[model samples]
Target: MSETKDTFFDFKLFKRLFKFIKPYKLVFFSLIICVVLLAGLSAAIPKLTEFAIDDSMTNKNPKDFVFYVTLMFAALILQTIFQLLFMYYASWLGQNLVKDVRINLFDHLLSFKMKYYDNSSVGVLITRAVTDMERIADIFGQGLFMIFRDLLTMTVVFGVMLYTNVKLSLIVLIMLPVLLYATRIFQKYMKKAFEEVRTEVSNLNSFVQERITGMKILQLFTRETIEHKNFKTINERHKKGWLKTVWYNSFFFPIAELSASITVGLVAWYGGLNVVLSDTVSQGVLVSFIMFIPMLFSPLRQIADKFNTLQMGMVAATRVFKVLDTTSHIDDSGNQIATSLKGDINFNKVHFSYVEDEEVLKGISFNVNAGETIAIVGATGAGKSTIINLLNRFYEIKGGDILVDGTNINQYTLASLRNQIAVVLQDVFLFADTILNNITLNHPEISEETVVEAAKAIGVHEFISSLPNGYHYNVKERGVMLSSGQRQLISFLRAYVTNPSILVLDEATSSVDSYSEQLIQNATDKITKGRTSIVIAHRLATVKKADKIIVMDAGEIVEQGTHDELLKKENGYYKNLYEVQFLQEKVA
Candidate 1:
């Protein structure tokens, strides 16, 4: 969110963008050839006009007139061909370059730690990858090379004008300093205006995405009017930023046009005076000087507008590069692969914190043997879920080590390590796709038959098949078409299909109806029978069947024992928690 440097042009940013053109070097060089051809051909037509007037028309020869006209026609045809080639190849290169950058950015995002996502906005990232990427394409397709073409045309036009008549060319040159000064002023302010516009665009996207996603909560709390006002404020800011650019454009272009028109009038006056009095300037030279002046000034005018396009692209590139430069990704340097990993897990005096000074889990130690089921019970902030996060290496531990199969977890490759554990969380998320695809996540190796069999093993196949299209039914975004309990069932089926060595279910049954809870409990029992499982739940009855229970309080284990063994302790933490939950259940 930091603003890029305030400058007319950024050399480093341009060099970074230019690197994307390397793969298509042949096409790029071909484009340069087209640009040169177009500029040269366009400048020739005006000179041809002078030839037809001075030679063919002056001699009163019909055959010579026809010959020069045909030559002019051929030049026009060649100009058209090169112009077509220039536009096509420029667009093709722009699209391919943007495609590569978008892919690289997406891959970088996937490697980032969860902590980064926790602190960033989904909408801001979407704008960078989607909207801003299109602006970068404009830099190549319409902005950069088009400016080059115009400048080359102007150069040829000015040189030819000077060669033909020095006095008249000086008349055109007198206006150059004033127009160039105006263009410089316009370019500077437009860069700042465009930077502001890009910032406002990102803010608008983030605000709208957040509001729409949370519309249900807004309506439930009756915050519609207040939110509308907030949206108006942001929308107004976005509009004003654009208007400033428009204001600058409105003020600058007329000055350029007026300057060009006055130059033409002055040249005509000077040439007419010489023709009638001294016979110094010929009528053909006067006509061509008139044509040449506009050709010279037109590109100067367009350069200002195209330069704005280039500036906007640079601003976008700066932002995108900032994201690509982030170094917060997890280290995947561990050479160990977790192939055929045993289910044993050990957390030896592990410590962690999301914030620097506020520890969430302090000196936590525990062990689960292969094929053992353990339960963790605690209050909301007692670090129950923190333990699960660490086990999956979603975060790095501050101290001590977590071992899987007697080797430090950090030594195992992340992909290989995570492939061996499956998690089912309380709030499940499903994509807007068929239920079968949602379960398999479009994995090439996971087939529909495997998903169906997994659903049957968890005893949800009958429920799924009863719906329209059975497993192929679309669940819509975030599984909105299904109930909370049904989504939880899908999460379980998803995990079961993986057949992981370690299973972690965090509050998996806390928010379901009694019937759904019973169904989930049965599925849980069947899946955890032989797998090493760790269950965390607020409902004491759910964990009563665990092989061993570890009771946590204030980031430390207060008791470790089986169900009856913990209950036998005199006024113990587990005994108090169980008794309270039992009384609440009886009252309900």
Candidate 2:
């Protein structure tokens, strides 16, 4: 993520944020009304004090004193009511907007191609969705309207001060430029500090998420000490980012305080000289001016602080909008739906690359007639998995075409196309959910009975039933409670229940024990009986029964034939690969 430049106010971002207000315009306007009332009432209280002291105290009139004090009390009550309304509605508006934005962001993320996930950090994306979104809520809750309210209150306070006595008002105005300059400097540096703080927060989240997820690997390699040191370094940088903001606050706030105190001192000195030397300024006016100076300065102080809040919110908004603005999603413009697919697949000179100009699949071509079983074999990074990804439209090919049922894959809707295929990947990911929910992925249409029947057909029903909760047992995160073979069986069961026309098992049987392998072999035979199946396996034995074997090396197919025919070519890629694996099995 790149740094968001330090900007005191971004009008475009503000305008974009206000667009969320369209849904809750009534609450927004009511909140505005409350803010206006609160500011007006707050400013009016001090004037009532000026009247109480001048008309009643100096004249020794008790009735006037009672009248003015009663009015001040009523104004205070009204101020409290409006303040409560302001806080509640402001928070309500902010939280609702956050909810909407968070949902949109998550939905947008779901639409992105697998290629996006390949390059982006999970932890960083999580921070943007969760932490950064919370910061945006502050824009409404404490930022824009609060700043406006303070400015309005200050305007009223200044008008009253000037009306009461021009000389004292002039004295108060003398210190304004010095304080304003200090605030401007503070606001500029604070924005930069906040940007650093947000950046460090994202870094910390990404580091922690990756570290926790890969903790097993870290421990297996005995890198605890090194990892601890690395974490400390990142954490220290996060601390320093925050400390910069603290330093700025500590420096600027005192300057604001001293300026306010000096203005009050100057007002009192000038007003006192008038009260004694001449009757130009009354003691009542002097007292009111004393009360008004802080009002004028307090808003000035709060405006700077609120501006910092506004900056932080805008920075967070910029990061979020960047994600929303990305066009990395696979095009879903095709309107054709894949229904009752015959499962005929053809890859016509397909070319693809994860990185620019470095092909992962180079002009790869193959054909699978309806209900035919094919196996792809190669060394690691031979682009075997890339074939499965393209088949499922998880990624778009750079050149050539992938056709399903004799129709170009791009012509079918992405969801409908993917629904016709079931892929059980090498690395199985299971949410922390019940076995039933994990198999059905919480689809309301798939019942427990259907899952059990599919499991029985796949030969894993007894294994799942033997668990503590039977079919309802929780798999935990990534099925950590189950052994590697058990997890693979669950993944196979998940695919079988989908009953897709085209089934893909990518190295599904490679990691299982002998017993699990036999069960998987039985399951494989049962599910692939009349469905188009593509199996990519490292073990030669697993692909021996495949209708056709396609040999791939680097990014291109080297050979394609039946198990017996491929071995007939003495120096062919498949013959050599089969010979090496056979020798390895003999050695074992």
Candidate 3:
């Protein structure tokens, strides 16, 4: 999955984003009205100044001068008030739009399948959610408002100037083309620079996040110096990207300033000649024309600056859309829903692979009768967990069919299928929340009594009770605050809380100490009672209690029988595994 290279000004993306603003149209229209009013006031300022110079100052009319001055002040005050309203409404609308966009994005992301997350990076997705969304908000709030005000002011001022003096306006207008050309060129370069900057910033954030999350591993290996060097490299790359953006901005502003100066100088020279030739046009009108030239160019310069911001915003939008545009490889096609399930599982000629032409499970067949426990033992990467993943429909099988209760698993709604199956993985994960919350994660409606009962059934309630806040104790990110045993216990309780018809325990007790292992073994015995279960374990003792044991090797099931039956196969994989563990027991 490659990041999108599409530009930010993509019409389709803007059209999609504009939908978020539609709900707040009334506020948006009010903002536009304020902007137009402010622009009209801005253009009127120079005219008022011109009137004061011609009639009040030249003719020496004190009462008229005072009156016009008061009117000018009143307009200034009105512009300020309208400007405040414009800012308030624009901010309100932008924030509301951002909230709406984020909610929609999050809802869509949650509906995506596991395959989507498998191909995407956590850091990149997080950047889109936080940083990219913020940039879009800033553009909608500040950039859009400025664009509207500057455009309206530019148009009105130019019209007035052309009407008052056409020749001078023509000269000033010539500079407009130059300004537009310069802005166009700058916009192209700035787009690439901003994209690079955003990429580098994402890289820096990824590095920092990984380092902090893996601080213990770095310290254990004494790799602080190497980590420091790696961070420095990322930091330097970000700095270089920033420097490039600054360089382009440096060139952009100077060109804009020079263009403004030339336009003003041209207007002054042409208007001055007109005044010298005849007294038809007042000195006030000439002064006003000069003022109008900068007024016109100032907005042009602003548009130039806004062009840069708009490009940056486009870059951010491109990133955000990339996440939103990703197509999930796995999708639920069936509409079947079941209120309950009888766990009769069958894997008929199952063939599977993570990638094409690389078979992980080949021609595998298995069956588990309702209310039975089966153990699948295999060497590392021998497809033990792959079998469990397929059973849960986490990854679709490339060939063959898996059925539950004589119906193909794919024929069932994904939610209904998953709700009936619970998995306790080898590497247990717990959210940074209360113990009660973690256990009740799948069933928030379950009462505290149910949570406590589930935790007690898993032998975790006693430990949780010893905590400072009991079940309400915060776990810290990824349950880092808890012991490995405690985390495993919580995972067990979570699966148990679901009361799933079919339970899959993949190395569920591997990481815990012997004391916790005994507790887990007892808990498993209780939980697996009368429930169809698949147990994947490395420890021979754990599978010894299973009703049936299947051994796998090289993507094929090599042997299948009860524990005693497999132990009797003198040369089989299961026999060898039993011998190794039995010998280790003797040595201990």
> lDDT tens digits, residues 1-588, model 2?
344655567887778877877999999889888877887898798889989999999999999999999999999999988898898889889989999999999999999999999999999999999999988998889998888899898888888777777878888989999989998899888888888999999999999999999999999999999999999999999999999999999998999999999988888888899899997998888888888888889889999999888888888999999999899989888999998799999999999999999999999899999999999999999999999999888888999999999999999999999999999888888889988888899878888889988888777889998999998899898889989899888888889888899999999988889899889889888889899999997666668889999999999999999999998997989888877885586477
Q: Write the per-residue lDDT of candidate 1 for residues 307-408, one digit (tens) a residue.
A: 989888888888998999998888778899997666999999989999897888899999999889999998889999999888888888999999999999
**Candidates arranged by lDDT, highest first:** 2, 1, 3
Error of 2 at 122 (Å): 1.6
Give per-residue CA lDDT, model 3, range 1-588, as digits (tens).
122444435666678788888888888788888888988999898999899989999999988899889989999999989988888787788778888878878877887766677776677777888888888887777776787789899999989887877777788878789888887787778777888889998888777877888899999999999999988898999999999978988987888889889888876777777778876667898899878877888888887677667666667876777777766645678888844688999999999988789999998998899999999987888999999888877787889989899999988888899989999987888888888888788475788898888777767778889998998998988999988987888888888888999999999988888888888888898999999999997655668888889889978999999999987886878889777764575466
lDDT at position 455, candidate 2: 86
User: Per-residue error at 340 for model 2, in Å?
Assistant: 1.3
lDDT of 3 at 378: 79
| Consecutive 10-residue window with the lowest summed lDDT within model 1 | 1-10
TM-score of each: 0.97, 0.97, 0.94
Model 3 residue 246 distance off true place after TM-score fit, in angstroms: 0.4
Clashing pairs in 3: 8-314
lDDT for model 2, on a 0 to 1 scale?
0.89
